[model samples]
Target: MYSEIIRLKELGLNISQIARHLDISRNTVYQYGNLNPDEYNQVLEDMQTRQKKLDHKREKILSWLKEYPDLSGAQVFDWLKERYPEIDISESTVRNYVSYLRKEYDIPKTIHKRDHEAIEDPPQGHQMQVDFGEEKLKNAQGNLVRLWFIAFVLSNSRQKYVEWLDRPFTTEDVIKMHENAFFFYGGRTKEIVYDQDHLILTSENSGDLILTHEFANYTRKRGFLIYMCRKQDPQSKGRIENVVGFVKKNFAKHRTFFNLERLNEDCLAWLERTGNGKKHNTTKKIPAEMFALEKPHLLPVYEKLNSTCKNSITRTVRKDNTIWFMGNRYSVPLGTYDGTEKVVEVMKVQENILVISDLETKQELARHTISLEKGKLVKNNNHGRDRSKGIDKYIETVAVFFNQPSQAKEWLKKIRAQKPRYIRDQLQMLQRSIEDVDVLITEKALNYCLKHNLFSATDFNDAIDYFGKMQPKERITRFGEADFIEIKPLNEMDRSKFETKPMTRDFNYYKEILERGHIC
Candidate 1:
């Protein structure tokens, strides 16, 4: 076309006449007519060797792939972008370059094979799969925000439900999402499939699944069986996995997220219009229509499943008798810490409160009001009372021995108020003096001190000394032979010295004694 325009212009026809003759626009005719043969050839050459932003860093990219063959093109692009900020290149350009280098260098790539067989459709309401996904999107402020979403799909009907979260889902969040998804579908499946998420399964030991305590309780109460996919096995839960990608591509991509509530509202609208309402590619049936058939076969929602969901974490009590939770240290009871290995369960019952319980006994040890500030200590004042147990017992003993319990208690309270730092040593000193001092003297001294409102231990000791010295001394009598009295037995002639007085027993005497209340 350019040659024809140029040739026509060279044949002496005007630009407008040549455009009319060639059935081309006059602008196109003038644009080609202005370019000389040399300039046109130069333009072709420039097109052949166009300099790309990634050309200068080609050697660096190839070297990275040579060193780490498993690294993806996106990873290499990110690395180069961080190191060489001036190099503006798109991710697709880097990927294409990496693909060319791999083929040119004959680098071996690992090929993964699907381990699970193709799945057949289960009975309606028989099975459902759940999975979580994360996406980075531009919010209304144009700042990049990371959002997480949980996807639930019915295997037979292909119906899907999704819930968006601003942060990573905790165990409680996971349970609540499950409840919401079931409610959205109008019922629960007989069995649910998961990808061994840590929120649900803690570990898989030798083919045996160890579920998290909270999720286990949820399953038990909800009356549903749980199936965990094998490790690294995406095909086991492919239905929900596909749904997760579908959401990202069709709903979230290129979408502005102003707020979480509005984003979710838009997502629900999209699902109603496109996601579940449209015919699925695999099933060729509208999910919403199929869901109506599946609804009746689903299990009924039990009231027992409405129990409060809590995030439980096992934390070791530190030597200071405290546990770390949500960026703060909360106190446990005094004896809660047996050692550093003593594990306690911290349950976040609500937003502001945490219940710390002993793992072995399952008894709540302390209730702490969660702190809003980070790195702050939330301590209970009575947690360290065990440290003062000995002093408290000593004060109680002193109070009882002085026979002025209230006075002793008041004096101790004064000491605690004034000399709290030396209270233990002072109590120990008072307890030691009890062994040496007489109880009566101590009681008398205490009475004097109480009357004068003197609470010092020194003052009480001085009073005891003064009162003891003022008391009269007892007389000591020594036994001697002159003070002894001799006694003789009745059989050895002592009977004569003793007067024999015998009273005759009579009914009248007994009656008079009874009447006088002396004898019966």
Candidate 2:
């Protein structure tokens, strides 16, 4: 206070000493310190009104400041300019008001918070961090497509690897990224970190590391330590977080990629040119320079790492003699073949390899090269032959025949890869001779038609049924019942009465019999 300063000066306080004590200017002290009684009273009143106005301003600014404690004064000024036009304000005015509120209200110091996972003094080659960022783009069709970009950074050197994916994040995606990152770095680090991806864990907040089972197995096999950031804590893995922005801004900015693969290739090229090649801000040496020191500490590239692969979950074959994977038709090895009740593991790990492995034995029973289009069924190999009218119907019949593999094996071996025509021929032959004989006789007959021409399994079945009904019945060994069998040729009385002509032993005659619909 200026009046208090005059009182202190009369008590022998020097101008320099009084100014410093009251945190005021020496000019102000000299002007007010010598004021007469009336003038000093007037000065005191003026000081009170100014102080009251300042106090009101301080309270107003502080009340607004409370809404955005982390915001800067300039930013607050901008916000106030747009939101509170009635409140006359300036950046300095807001700043001074906030300063006064801080002193008067005793607010605590503010610090920019970061995740505890970030190391204060990171050791070279000690840790590598991984994270994913998303970008929006228009594809060739001019439709918006979202691409996922995964980045890995070395803490000390800041060397990085970035890749793009068109699909949503998956545990498989995470593992593949790590594999490629290790290859890119030429070694593995002692510790690696990841975010809360479902493929990793649903929710890891309780301090329990609930990693996906597959991911756990993968890390355990590789002997790498994995750490995840606390939920909503970005500063925890600041190295990767910074690299994500750096790579995107520097490399991905104006560039366009046709697909995920091309985008990833571009990302790799950019990472090498920007993040890895440039000198790091904190390290003071180029990343390539600091990376050399970390090189030897990393684990040597694993030879078997090349074998790791991924397949999209699209197809599934169920246990009920039906195939239901990715909403497509795929045949099993046939007939209640219990390959363990576990879900079918469709191995799309490599290029289009579809392996149906038995869950219990972990043995693959069926495999086919899948066409690229999803839901397109490659006929199941277990359906060995086609003795049917059409390809699909033939597949269905073969599927039925294999329902009794042992019984069908003899027939199947003969017609391992027969065409529908041969099967149709066989059916015509079987039905022609069934006119005068018992149809049940034809049912039991095992006439193996092994030819590629008969691509009709349905025809083969009909023929088998026809012959099955024609044969004479021998006595049932188990039931002790004498089963009557149908005789195809004429008996003595019928033979003598009309010398009737039977079917000639010729393929054309069989064809004639089929055209006439002799057998239903």
Model 1 clash tally? 0
Cα deviation of 440, candidate 1, in Å: 49
Provide the lDDT at 159 for model 1.
Answer: 90
RMSD of each: 26.3, 23.7
Cα displacement (angstroms), candidate 2, residue 131, comes to 0.6
Q: Write the per-residue lDDT of candidate 1 for residues 192-289, one digit (tens) a residue.
A: 99997767776676678767677788888788898889999887788999999999999999888888999888888988999899999999999999
Residue 455 CA displacement from its true place in model 2, Å: 59
Tens-digit lDDT track of model 2 for 412-495: 434434533465454344335433333233224333333333434465556566565453354232233545544565544555
Identify the leading candidate in terms of lDDT.
1
Best of the candidates, TM-score: 1
Give lDDT for model 2.
0.64
Please give the CA lDDT of all the candidate structures. 0.80, 0.64
